[model samples]
Target: MNSEPANRRIVRAPRGTTLTARSWQTEAPLRMLMNNLDPEVAERPEDLVVYGGRGRAARNWEAFDRIVATLTDMSDAETLLVQSGKPVGVLATHPDAPRVLIANSNLVGKWATQEVFDALERQGLMMFGQMTAGSWTYIGSQGIIGGTFETFVEAGRQHYGGDLSGRWLLTGGLGGMGGAQPLAGVMAGCSVLAVEMRPAAIARRIESGYLDREAADLDEALRLIDEAKASGTAISVGLLGNAAEVYEEILARGDLPDLVTDQTAAHDPLQGYVPAGWTIDEWESRRERDPAGVIAAAKVSMARQVRAMLAFKARGVPVFDYGNNIRQMARDAGVEEAFDFPGFIAAYVRPQFCRGRTQFRWIALSGEAEDIRVSSEALKGVVSDPTFTRWIEMASERIRFQGLPSRSYWMGLADRVAAGLALNRMVAEGVVSAPIVVTRDHISSGSVASPNRESEGMLDGSDPVADWPMLNAMSACSSGATWVSLHHGGGTGIGFSQHAGFACVADGSDAAAAKIARVLGNDSSVAVFRHADAGYPEAVETARAEGLRRPYAEALRG
Candidate 1:
């Protein structure tokens, strides 16, 4: 923790129609950066950690202050450049240029390992940005709750005959993304046992309303789970224990959970995943004292955790890797069958994602729930997908907006574009209180290359190629995104993945309208084309049905 006076506490953003910057474009990033650090949104605001292990909003307090200062005075025609959460430069550009361009945790292929990253971070040169954390679009665990709920619902449909009542889910970690699991499981009508090592993590989840209770020990946790299961009450319990140890103990017991998964920060072992035998304080200190040794221990611990999950899978229990790349870490640690279970995306989300739908979100600029309500009502009118409509309704009733009032769901190409256009019209007509900023995870078509997660089992075996995300970023930039980011080592560990992010603000102007139309259309079209090129029939059908203009689609049409 930086003890500097400017860096020691939770930072809150100015709310309600006040622009500290020259324009909303600049203010958007500024407020979002601060919002990400808000006590309600961030897991550890004092250290700038928003989620995942050390995934941070800025490299350090100095960098965070600099980025804020730069955004404050930056002209509307200027673009700010951020590298690994540090403000690097400002360039004069056109109105269409992205207001912010960011590259986080990006390393050259030869040196793209956690060891190198840790060394750089120790020297104040880099930081891990974990998915939405560094991109400045994280809207708290609610941002992740809907997707997790969908996954659980799908799991129920596949295995439990579309019913998860009276069941229990076993998982690990309570980081930013993982914290949503408990609430999602409850929403799916299942009891959840989420094992987290840190008391702070458990407290945060409880405070955020995602967790219902904390167990005193493994025995107490099991008792709570059994009680919940017996009563068929949907609830979430946080167990304070080491994941590896808890998993091994669970394996020792005969009965297996209905579903099993993990979200421990196994991707970056040295700093992300805590070793089993060490205390949290010890783990944190030893990481600095002996990073290589810490990595070795953590990898072994992860291998143990994976082996336990494998045991549950062998018992015919539903198990999946929650896109944390822990299996790869275990594999590296000599667990030959570490990947016996499939990734969550591969098992549940890929089919929908093939049609250019993944985790999508929109934030109301005014930070008012009523603004969100108006946008929601307008979105309901435009989107015809009954699934998405129900999702919006469920989310509105359940999810508590942590920072800026926001709504998120999974919608394919056509519905996404329609929703964007509808929100734009509402903004233009003053039906919505303020402009809406739309965002998506870095998992879109041509936006990510992660063999273990997003691109797992890709039809064309193009999972490891990095060109797609670069193209995705460029396409978003050309298509009028307000800001675009290209990042490495998100979801998966360093050297294993590259992804891009897009954010477009609907400001009620004609330019905003045109941008939303083009960006949303082109952004989704690229995914359709990517999937079609890979020989997915549904992607092909969607492309033909929507009359998308892409080389592959045009060629097929001819």
Candidate 2:
């Protein structure tokens, strides 16, 4: 801690039409980068840690300041080039080119291990990007709430034959991405028991209206879970304990849950997961002083947790990996049966990906809730998806704004374009107070190529192909995205994944409208094409119906 950066201070995004940059195109990324580190959003902003352990917005405070300064004075015709969170160069380009182009955490295959990454990081050469964090699109924990809720609802349809009312979901971890699980479970009409090692995380979720109850002991947490299930009520209970320890204890008790999954940060064992029987302080200290020991201890603990998950799977529980790379960690620790269960993406989210639907979000730069409301209401006009409408309504009522007021639309490309255009028109007409930034999670259908997560099990067994995301970044750049980022080793950790991110501002200009239509359509078009190329029939059908011109696909159809 003594060696960390000295710039430990509060940071917030500028609100209400303040022009810190030359234009909204430049200002959008600046505001989002600041928002990512907001005390209300970032998991540990003091150390530059945003979400996943050390998934920073910039390499250091110096890099952060430089990035902000670059964006502030940048011309619309110049594009800033960032490498692993450092602003490397600003080159002359056309106005339609991406204002910022970033490449983070990209290591050659031979040197992509966590050990090498840790060494380079200690020398201040690189930083982990972790999906949305480095790309500056994170919307706090609730950013993932809608996706998690839909996953639970889909799980209900698959196993329990449609409602999850009296059922209970047993899962672990409540940090960052996992923090959404508890509330998502309740919103899906189920009771949930989530085990987390941090007391502060539990309290934070409760304060954010994402968790309903908190317990310091396992027995008390179980009591709460039981009472909710018995009354057929939907509620979420966050229990303070190490996931590995609590999981083994639960396995000993032999009471099965309706669903099972995990979100512990097992991907970066040295800094992510907490080892069983270790105090949080010990874990933190050992992470810096004895990284090898921390990794070894976390891996051993992860094996224990995986064995318990396997037991639940053998007992017919709807168990799966929630994409934290826990199974991979356990496999490295000699747990061969660890991967008998499927990943959540392979089992649940792939069909949606095939249809070009994922997590799309828009943030009101004014930080006004009414601005978000006006935009979300515009979405209801484009499509009558009851699920979409219900989520929007519930989120409006229940979710609290973190840093910037935002709304998520889990919809297809056409609806996304229509909604975005409507918002742009509203901005022009003064229906909304300021510019809105439209973006999507890096885990979208066409954006990521992580075999352990997004592309877990492709139809053509092309899970390891990295071309899709590379093509995605190029497509977004060609389509005039405000910022286009290509990242390596984000979602599942070093050496395991690659992804892309794109976000553009809707500033109510003709240029902004052109970029939104092209980029948004390009986003879904590339997704359908990728899945169709992978031999998914749903993807093929969607491609044909959407009039996407793939010569081979059209030839095959004829």
Candidate 3:
């Protein structure tokens, strides 16, 4: 990690000019791990929290140091075994084998609840590795911005005639993923009123340019929203108030915004959620001393919040849950109709997933914007898919590079590997400065079991079957991924989901080319197979068109 001895706090990965490890394979994991800790990439690096509620890059500082030391000295023939961010063992393996194999937050099904997980966690037995956090694949907030933008765009299409001019959106809880909502809504041409209790959270969004203004109260927030809407200007306003109370007040007045949703950390009641009437300080103190009390209070508050959201749906305004499992919390708190609204994924993202159009990210190892530009152009040159070509051009023009000058676009299985191989050739030809580090969410198809979110309402009802991600990880490692990981409790919280992820470095070598071709192709092919298996007609057509040898998919298609 890059650092000066005078100030040890700012740790970023070293960039420019060559490989430090024994080989590029070893170098990829080492640099990517440090990149995850870079101040620009991580949400809270000092605490090792990368993003989400408590998703960490490593188990602890000690573990982080050890992992770095291990990766620095380990050879390509020796594979490091990381269990929940701790490097526990090393074993000799073939060159094609992954340099690192990781399993994080895995627990027996019966013992997967938060109470048991916490006991083991405090004993240093496990850590919650939310999606890309522990897997060393996080591409910062921009990664999520694309998905959020798509949701609002879909909302506009469904309810606002494909345009959000002179429209406004109302949502709550501006934590990590939720913080993207304001910017996404504005980007889709709608003003947004985001209700968040924490002043620090509101300030963070404003500083990041995700929010345009912060209002003192609901009246001021409403005024700002109205003014922005009237001017046909998109803006985001952060309201300083409890989400539950704010939504309820709007419900009482029968003056609701055009859309409703939430991104509060309601997945974890004790830690992620703040109870109504409790100050941040009190909430923190009580979380340590009275967790049960905190959970109870938070559940009641979430119920009220969901009740108000249901009121918006009742009034015929589009309402959805932003994948925090807040509806479940409210339902558990005795609000029987809490699930009246759908999750954002179920509403807008699943169709894209069926077509294998999901978060496809690549990082510029050189950390140079020109490298990204060159690679994007290189990718655009080879692929004739007009959708992808247009997206590449639009992304390079519109999306600001965040945390390592990375870029992501949603492409299906058909052309994803084509793009990867094109970028690899560019790197080999010296058209770009460094290799592109490709990554995706841990919850890619055939690689996640989340009943409430990604796998919700599966045709075959395989949402709780946890073996898919395990199979996906094995496939990745066998297909020549530099590193492969399987994680539990990624997005929907502990015991709720299991997923896997992989990182492949494209360094412009024959070996790198072969690996990228196999990994990217197979990785995305599994998504097509997964959706085909689930009876998605589009996926079945894609599988046949791509010549994937899935007999069951063929039979199902027939």
Off by over 4 Å in 1: 1-4, 556-558
| Candidates in descending TM-score order | 2, 1, 3
Q: Whole-model Cα lDDT per candidate?
A: 0.85, 0.88, 0.82
Model 3: worst 10 consecutive residues (lDDT sum): 1-10
Q: Total clashes, candidate 3?
A: 0
Model 3 agreement with the true structure over 124-238: per-residue lDDT tens digits: 8888788888998887766777788878989899888999988888888787677778877887788999888789888877876777899987888888878877777888999
Evaluate residue 420 in candidate 3 and report its C-alpha lDDT on the 0 to 100 scale: 78
Once fitted onto the true fold, the runs of candidate 3 whose alpha carbons sit more than 4 angstroms away are: 1-8, 383-399, 553-558
Q: Write candidate 2's Cα lDDT for 307-349 as tens digits.
A: 9899888889989898899999999999998889999999988
Two-way lDDT contest, 1 vs 2, winner: 2
Candidate 1: tens digits of C-alpha lDDT, residues 116-161: 8777988999988887899998899888787788889999999999
Better of 1 and 3 by TM-score: 1
TM-score of each: 0.96, 0.98, 0.94
